[model samples]
Target: MTAIAIDHDKPDLTGDTETQNDIFLQVFNSGDGALFDRLYRDDAISNFSGEPLTGEARRKFFVEFIGAKPVLEARVTHSYVAGDVALIGVDFSVKGTGPDGQPFTIEGKCTDVLRRVEDGRWLMAVDRPVAAGGLLPE
Candidate 1:
């Protein structure tokens, strides 16, 4: 079966990380990994598992992560922009059923670094979600 793509009519990724946050949530909830990946750079890093993951590892992780059919909620806590770069802080939660058929929920805050490419589109360079105490194993 073929799937049809929908145009959300949202603005293109620009200098507004605030609006991008909303777009991120929408794409995430849609569970379209290919579309979701467009929000990040080719070499982007995601610390979702408490370890920095990039390259094919990151793509594989995201594929599994999205396969859980997780639902996400994110709120932009703070954002700062300088030149072609931006840093955004977000509080978020995700709930879904694991591959083992167990229900799981994760709530945390994330720090994201974004950069505007030559085409004037902002993409995440780093995405690191931290626990409440801001601690991760060394």
Candidate 2:
């Protein structure tokens, strides 16, 4: 597993930034539906690789992606929160053999927006990836 190096100076906006990041890492490394239930709102929306996702669609996307290529590692390069919105920038890589028997790896950066609900629970509102050397897809 590759070690993800997080910048020590990154602001922990909500005082629970580390906790939230850890939860996200765990959820990605393990295809745990319960984690999804905790981290994403019912109306959560995500854009990845040109696809728009929401609700169950978003949940399934995470589940399937994690299931297929168990995250080898992830690092939060930057993170910030203002008011009820949190933006996290992460660098991650997944290592695994594809169904075609070819080894595949994807290294990319993701900017995830988390919103604090009325109940004070944080849930992902937008999760988008901007691949290195490629245009940001919507």
* Candidate 2 per-residue C-alpha lDDT over 63-125 given as tens digits, one digit per residue, 9 for 90 to 100: 666666455466788889898888888887666676678887667877888888876667788
- The list of candidate 2 runs beyond 4 A from truth reads 1-15, 133-138
* Stretches of candidate 1 exceeding 4 Å from the true structure: 1-12, 132-138
In model 2, which range of ten residues has the least summed lDDT?
6-15
lDDT of 1 by residue, 12-131 (tens): 456776677777777777776666666678898878766888878877777778756799888899999999989999999888898898998888888999998877778888988886
TM-score of each: 0.84, 0.73
RMSD of each: 4.7, 6.6
| Model 2 residue 99 distance off true place after TM-score fit, in angstroms | 3.3
